[model samples]
Target: MRLPCILVLFLGCGSPDQVQPEIKQLNEIPLNIRDKTEVDERTATVNDTLPEGWVDVKSLIPELVLDIRYATSDNFVGIQLYPCERCLLRKEVAEAIAVAFEALRADNLGLKLFDCYRPRSVQEALWRKVPDARYVTNPAKGSMHNRGAAVDLTLIDQNGHEIDMGTEYDFFGEKAYHTFTKLPAEVLTARRKLRDLMQEVGFKHIRTEWWHYSYQIKNYEVSDFRWPCPGQAL
Candidate 1:
């Protein structure tokens, strides 16, 4: 159940649409989340201020709707959903992405943020879905997704069709491996383009998953403690 990144094929510059209704005020804890009360004690806390150069993407790529919610089988199983509203990353990360989008769009390309700023509580719920020692990270251990730093993303062409990245988002197998030798050269190049562009905008990708990247998570040694998402008025 990875977030939807379905690219649409179209053209011409158009004003961005209103953010999707289901995508906003995403504070309710889905019923299936494991322990709503369990909080990560070791999580780190940060100042409320956003760094410079980061711009909110709500208006930048409004055509690319966000579905940042729990998935029965999203990456890392179910542990990466936003646990609390405020607990997600500050808005600056989205801003940074918007800047990156502006640069990418100049070349007729666009970005699709599959996941961003997850709450630690949602990570706990994800653990319950697949508590296996191999696939999921224990909330007690911490997850990059729990921090505002990590994001799952992909690219879209001018026509809006998503460029093939060799496998579906959150495909949990060898095919999903960024280094899989079986992938074609062209697909690999497209993957690298997304990776390089994100990196240029100050993001770093995880070795196993090319679609996953981080902005500020590299500086923090721990995930953020569960909190709430930013207020709607923001």
Candidate 2:
């Protein structure tokens, strides 16, 4: 379903260049903890030990491939948003994704992740660059990615070639919408297979983006913690 424009605007109001100052102000705003149970239930307590309930997808499902476009300048923004090319997701969501990967494996296929678990700060940077609700979600409300409950992904064949999905990942147009038909039969079939597998494992597809899906069984808090990058001094 389409997110309400008013909500998008209300939550994501500033421009990209203004992100630093806005982030400073946002930090002053305390998290609402009245729903402590909700936070406790969904928030993964991460530590150096690689705690339970939150995991790096690559480690858990080695066969699943990662493109992690945000880690490079190939994305629409033309800026490297992530310091590393790691796919982090809540434990349950990661497990469900693993299940989907196994399902695809039966057909000699695998899953390729484009994006996952985006930091809230990066969301602000994206807002500053795009500033359009049509393409990017407002950082104020936080997206499912920020919650570690969503993923942008596609399917790959046994040879590791990407299957056609009508359009490339992050294509900002109607052609990328799941409802936009008018494509080759193979492309449509590929999209259907991906959607069916994701839904079967409890992920919900957004109508506007064929590659995007959010886990439906649980909720999570928006997080600003950035993953550590390689070569950084401890």
**lDDT leader:** 2
lDDT of 1: 0.53
TM-scores for all candidates: the values are: 0.61, 0.77
Off by over 4 Å in 1: 1-56, 59-64, 69-88, 132-135, 217-234
lDDT measured at residue 38 in model 1 versus the true structure, 0 to 100: 31
User: Which segments of candidate 2 are over 4 A away from where they belong?
Assistant: 1-52, 230-234
Write down the lDDT of every candidate, Cα atoms only.
Answer: 0.53, 0.74
Candidate 2: deviation at residue 48, Å? 3.8
Per-residue alpha-carbon lDDT of candidate 1 for residues 1-234, written as tens digits (9 for 90 to 100): 111222210210010121121311112322111133331111212222223322234433345545453532355453445443221344445545655666666688877667665556766776787675344458787766665667777888877777899987766676766556477887877876775566555566665666777774235445444443454221
Summed over model 2, clashes come to: 1
